[model samples]
Target: MTVDVRLITESEYPDWLRAVHTGFLQPPVASDEEARSRRPYTDLARTRGAFEDGRCVATFRSFAQQITVVGGAALPADAITNVTVTPTHRRRGLLSRMMAADLAAAKERGDALATLIAAEYPIYGRYGFGPAAGVAEWTVDVPRTGLDRRWSRPESGRIDLVDGANVRKLGPDLHDRFRAVQPGAVGRDERWWATRTGAEQLPDHPWTEPFYAVYRSPAGEIDGLLVYTADDKWGDAKQPLNTATVLSLIAVSPAAERALWHYLCSVDWITTVKTGRRGPDDLLPLLLPDPRAARITLQADFLWVRLLDVVRALEARTYEAAGTLVLDVRDADGLSAGRYRLDATPAGATCAPTTESPDVTLDVRELGALYLGDASAVRLAALDRITEETTGAVARTEALFRTAVRPWCPDVF
Candidate 1:
């Protein structure tokens, strides 16, 4: 059977949505109104649908976002999302065709890089996408005896508890201010914030009302805030459990972070607390009287990144350790294939197409692997994807690319 690929029209969006939603186990299906609302920010004109027998059988959406690249200038990036294919349409090269077309369109539109949250890890790697960021989920069992006495004695900052609805309204402004200076962070628009806070109806896991606690500085500035809820019965009923969960925590400074955690843990009648997302270098443990009370588990959560333009993506981010290096890159798709030389100094990295000697040769996927903290140059060399000329070239390259903190994505697109 012949399959036709074309842009989806507004009238045919519902059919396209149905096809993609069917592919999701717990699809966050959007209403016609919600989909329409998002059209302004997304590249809807490029959203492709594959039709079999004149019926939409597969769909994918691509949109542009402004990402803050570390050590280099921020640039416009393309994000591939809502990629889905009906089960029956699988293995027919439908997705391959759609991706090639979409990526070509992205390059033509001048996107430096492309990112996506992959539903399946193996599929996108062949398409030149590499894991870029990660989010770690944590569960902490706060013991009654483990509560720190220092945290129990609250200090001078005035804490005001407000309604969650009001907090939702305030989230966008706060997040915008926070992301401005935070490296490797993306801006969350009002609509994204609404969806995150559950102010608007989503497909699955409806938002639960959250309590907002705003911490004011001595000068009366809203320096920090936390959105959380309490669960009286988090542990076994026979054992009696008191747990408070932190849905989101934002603080402008280190002191604010300490004060916020202290306030949350000091809540009356709550013996235990848990936060699903915390930074790898989070200071919570440092503030704890006994570090053993806080348990941390690290799991690999992947975020894939694809460099659309080799020179542009490399020049976009800043490099910490200064070095001169050459990379021989192979692309599955013909767009980004070549040897590139990257020279780094305290100023920044200068990347360009080169025909000179290559210190290390690798595929585009290997490059993507190194772009995020997920995979190191040494590992890629061990896998035979990277050929290092010097004994420590891989190690030196890894040190140059290492970020201060592991890149993380707290929000799921």
Candidate 2:
């Protein structure tokens, strides 16, 4: 049987949605009204569906976005999401065809990069996607007092607890302000905010009505906000011990971040607090009296970024130390293929083709690894994947390409 690939039309939305929910095992399929609400932001033209005998078997959606790089420049990018294939259609190469078609479309649209939070990691690596960000989950016993002494009494900042539903509106503003100065942070559009907060006039998830707390500095400027929910007696109580969990917490500024942590730790009647999906370099240690009370679990996988245009992707981000390096990138799939010289300084980077002075040669996947700061040039060279001709070119390239902080994405797409 041959599978047909085509754009999903408005009339076919019900079938498409049904296939998606069943394929992904999403509980309780979304209603027609809910689907209608999501239609505006979704690009139906970019949504592809594979069908066998007039039945939808696979589907995916792609949307264009303006992603702000670590340094500050905005680049045209594509976010591939909502990819799912029916069980009956699995291992039939439907996904590969869909992805290839979508990527080709994105390339034709002039997208320089593609990003997504993979539902499964292994499936994406073959597509040239590399893990570009990570989230660290932490647990702490509130009574341990490790956080007590280090926790400075927060200065006067106006904090207002608002309805969680209102978070959809306020989150974008807070995120926009936060990403402006933060390196390796991506921008969130309305659709992204709506999906995260479950507020796009869609069928909502009852378990996820998170509370929003907005923080204003003494100067009366809104600097930070947190979306969180408290879970009481969350763990096994049979052992004579119980715990509380802080489901989510996002702070936009350093002061606001500290204040939010203080508030969470001080919540009464909670023996322990569990916070999942936070920055790898979260400031809890600095604010805690005993840093030992904060137990951090280092877990990988967050956002996967694929460079569609090497020059644009390389030049978009800021460099730490200054240096010039040549990159010989091999793309097995022929998506990103080129040899270019990246001249990077503290200011930014300028990438162009070079006929001489080759410093490093690596594959596109390795380049993706380097771009995310997950694998350094020296490490790749030692692994025999990156070839370095000069004495300290590896070190120089690593230093020049290092991000301001370890790349982390607290939000799962």
Candidate 3:
């Protein structure tokens, strides 16, 4: 049985769409209304499919994205999404065939790296991808965690609780500013903003009515946005405690962050406030009188990265410490396999192909893990995923790659 893999043409979009929905076990989007709802999430030209007997059996696509690396440089990234293979085509190597073509196309298009929210943890690692950054779930008790100077100093800004309709104007600009300061952050496209902020509705996933708040800075700049929903609940003692679940909280400045959290905690009848996601190095717990105030319920890798162009990806981001190290990077697909020397300084890193002896040896996956400045070289070496070919190489590599704020990707896509 032969499976043909290629980009779906404009005329074949309906079949391609159905194939993707089916692969994910979603009901066929049969009507005009349904199609319009789903259209924003897809780029028809970029969507790839695997056809067996003239029917698309697998689906894949990537959004045009720029991910912020260490030192505030945005690297061209292909944020892969809508990946699916129908159960009928399971274990047939359809995924591998499609992934290879997609990755090659992305690299040829000059995207330095590829990123995705892994539907399954173990699948992407073999494709030269590694778990780079993760999300943390915070459950905070509203009663104990007061907003009085715990999160930040007294703020001159005020949070105005707005509606979903108003978010259409404020969200995109605010998020662009927010992703800039954080390393490993991926930019959200217009489609993502519309669907996520409740400006547009999609099929299967019903938009839950949520409250939107805008944080205005002292100088009257809109810098932060928060979207959340509440469910009124009471304990056995009839306490009027409701639950406020934070869907998305984006703040461009420390003052804006404090104001958003302060507003949520100050909401009337809110018993517990929960967070959708935060970075592993989040200072939420420390902001309260009790360091153990926010209980992190879930801690798991949220973003997986694949270094498609090793030299390009390395040179795109800046390093903190100054050093020179040669790396022998092995790529299973041979796309980025080569020895590259990386010279680092406070300014930026310059990486190029070199014939020099490597001080460290590793696969593209481990390098992807280190690309964002989260995973340490010594840690990977201890796990045998990385090899230190020279004395003191691991420590030197660690010092060169350390980032002030651990990388965190806010958007799921």
Candidate 4:
């Protein structure tokens, strides 16, 4: 059967939405309200669909984004999301076609890189994407945290239970401050806050009214925000056994993080707290008196990145020490393949194409993994994913690329 893969028109949006839901194993129906709610934010030019026999069988979309690199430099990124392929359309190269088109356009538009939250582990590597960051979720046994039962207020800041309206008003600016210092972080749009705060609602996925709490410093400045929901549970004898699950938590300061966590563990009848996805090396576990009280519930790769412009991506972030290296980046798709010389110093960095002998050779996907500074070149070399042509090149790469703290992308998208 012949399939047509191209950008969807504005008139085909409802059908596209249905295709998306169907591909994702949702209700397989898109209501008019759902289309209308999402249409304003949808860019038709960047949204593509694979149609066969007048039915959309696959869907893909990308949007403008800014990703924070090492040293807090935000680079232009093409953030891919809402990608789905119906089971019937699998193994037909539908995704490859859509990805090639989108990436070509992104490179033409001068986007430094492309990013996505991989739903599966083994799919995107063939498309020049690599796991760039990891996420961790902890389930804390509150009673074992060894905190005082009478603990209510923090020593430095105070936590206030605010409403969603207040979060919509204060969230954007606070997130900006937090993202500025966070590597691997991505910028959020206005619609993100609106939908998250329930200013606008989605039909297919209904929004629950979650409790919003904001942490204020002693000087009266908002520095942290926490959203959580509690489940009501009881034993056979009517003993309370509740779990407070954090939906989202953003803090710009360590004090704010400590205070919010302390407040959660101290809530009456709250026997457990599920800390949401956090940085792999997050302070959540260490904040507790007994670090072992916070049990690891989930640890997995979260963010994947694909480099489009090797020079721009390599030069956008800072290095740990002064060094020069010739890197031979191999890209099977030839989107970002070249031998480049990178001269990095304490002040800045410069990368450009060169004919010099390579000190190290690797694929563009591996470079994407190393770009955020969380990945270790030595480990990749040990795994045979990287080839060190010169003596001690792998160690040099490790010293230059690894950050003190692991890179974490807080938002899934």
Candidate 5:
């Protein structure tokens, strides 16, 4: 029997979701409540499935999103997720077909790029995606931090424990303020907040109530929010050996960040704190009095980007310095291929197809890496991933593309 790939009907969602779970090695089940909860947020036309013998065997979906670029401009993105193929149907071109259709639709829709969090590093590159941002995690030994255990309140702000309702009320506005200035950050929708705060729970995923802490500046403005859970353990002699794990921490200011870390370190009975995935160069370690007290647990690439429109993607970001260069962007899929001239300035940039000779020649995947100002063109050139057609073009590319602070995407998509 031949397999068919096409956009799934609303009636086929459950089968599609079950196929997703099966591909991910999870229980292949979707409850009615779960289906109801997800349907409202899903755009059915963008959800495609591969069917064999009247059953879904592969799944892929994309949604509307906005990602902040180098100078804090949010570009419309086609955010992909829930991609999978059954083991029985491996290497059958299902993923490629689904991806091609989606990318074509995205280009027609005028999205600047497509974004995803690659579960495996090697999978997305062949699809023209590249690692754009990285994440870091650390485990802190509270006893070695050398902080006052008797610390009570923040020096310049106050920390207050609030409930999920309060977080739902304040988080969206605060996140808007944070993502506006933070490169590589993506927008979060109402469903994300609702699911995180227990407004709606998906089936087969257990939820634990976490403690929420909000930091207010001296003027009483909310600038930070911390969500954490604790494991209760006791030593043989009745000493507390609890460890607090941070689920999410959002801070808009340095003072708010410092105050939250201070509060976590001083909490009674909490001997260890696990900082969840953060930006590779997060301030958590430096915030501690003894920086060595925090040991890195994870350092890996997090967000992956694939440029759909080369010209628009280049013009969407602001350059760090003034320079003009031509890029020979090679896309094997023939979606976004051509030599383009980019005239960049600190103020803004303009990119368009031109007949000018190339100064730097690179694949579209490499441009995705450089788009958010995270990856260095000079380093990629050294790796032979990029060619500098003109002397000093790589340096100019490096200077124009690199941001003072590395790009960091807090959400996984």
Candidate 6:
């Protein structure tokens, strides 16, 4: 069957919404509610659908975003989302066609990279996206874990609970401040904030009725925030064991991080505090007297990055060490496939296409995994995803690509 692919029109948004939600196996949203929910941030110009027999069979969209790189630079990225195709449309080239079109458009518009939080690990690598970072899930036995007394408390910050409605007013500014310093964070527009705070004007949105809190400095400045929800469980022995699950937590400083974790553990009737999508190097372990009380229960890929322009993406971020390497990048899409020379110093980096022999040969996906400095070149080389053509080249590249902070993407979208 022939399928037509084109940009979705404004009049067809509800149908677009239903098509995507249905394809994902989610309950359909009420048309009236969706219409009432304003989505200026949705950018219909970037939304597309695959139509067969006058009905949408597949959907895709990419929002403009600023993704933080090493050294605190926010580079342009196309945040791909709402990717779905009906079950009947599976095995067709719909996914490939949509991804190629979206990526090509993003590249043509001068985006440095494209990013997504992959729902399934194996599907995106073929499209040249690599798992650039990993997040660790923590299940903290709160009762067994005591706050580290030796840890100096925040000088001026105080943690205070706030209502979900208050999050609408405070979350955006606090998040902006937090994102400025955190590598791998993506900018969240107003629409995203509205959705998180349940202020998006949509009725019965998914997620718990969020309990929000903020860490405020003595100077009355918000330094950190946590959004979470809890479910109370009763045991056969008549015990109240409630679980507090952290949906999102952003702390600007180490002090704030410690304070927020402590506060979460201290919540009344909470037997366990769980959080995920936090960087592997999260500080909760360091914040507790018994570090073992907080166990890493799960760890896996989080942010997947795809470089749209090899030279631009490589040159955009700050480097830590001085080195020169030639990379022969292979891309199935042929968008960023070529040999390029990268000269990186602690000061900055410069990259351009080169005709010289390559010191390393790898796929563009591996190159993207190395982009944020979370994936080590040596590791990828050992995994056979990357090749070091010369002796010590892997070591040299690894040293140069190391980031000061382990990159983590806290933002879901």
Clashes of each: 5, 4, 0, 0, 0, 0
Q: Give the TM-scores of the predictions, in the order they appear.
A: 0.88, 0.89, 0.93, 0.98, 0.98, 0.92
Clash pairs for candidate 3: none
Greater-TM-score candidate between 3 and 4: 4
List the global CA lDDT of all models.
0.73, 0.74, 0.83, 0.92, 0.92, 0.85
Which of candidates 4 and 6 is the stronger one according to lDDT?
4
lDDT of 5: 0.92
Off by over 4 Å in 2: 27-30, 148-153, 164-170, 191-201, 234-248, 389-391
**Model 6: pairs clashing at backbone N, Cα or C within 3 Å:** none
Model 1, 204-305: lDDT tens digits are: 455677788877778877777788888767545556566788888877766677788878777766777787676555677767766666776655545678
Give the least accurate 10-residue stretch of model 5, judged by summed lDDT: 198-207
Clashing residue pairs found in predicted model 5 = none
Which residue window of length 10 is worst by lDDT in model 1? 144-153
Candidate 1: what lDDT? 0.73
Q: What would the per-residue lDDT of candidate 4 be over residues 1-413, giving only the tens digit for each residue?
A: 79999999988899999988888788898989889888988899899999999889999999999999988889999999999999988999999999999999999999999999999999999989989999999999998998875899999979999998899889999999999888989998888998888888887667889999899999999999999999999989988899999999989999999999998888888999999999999999889889999999999999999999999988888988889989999999999999999998756799999999999999999998998888999999999999999999999998888888788998976
lDDT tens string, model 6, 40-154? 5578888999989878888899988899888778999999999998888888989898898899899999999999999999999999999998889899887788764243345
A best-first ranking of the candidates according to their lDDT comes to 5, 4, 6, 3, 2, 1
lDDT of 1 at 384: 86
Q: Write the per-residue lDDT of candidate 3 for residues 267-373, one digit (tens) a residue.
A: 77786889888899876777666656688898989888899888878887888799999999999899889999999898888899999999999999998888888
List where candidate 5 sits over 4 angstroms from the true fold: none
Regions of model 4 farther than 4 Å from truth: none
Candidate 6 residues lying further than 4 Å off, grouped into runs, are 28-30, 35-40, 148-156, 164-166, 204-209, 218-220, 234-239
Off by over 4 Å in 3: 28-32, 146-154
10 residues in a row with least lDDT, candidate 4: 199-208
Off by over 4 Å in 1: 26-43, 149-158, 164-170, 197-199, 203-205, 232-240, 296-298, 372-374
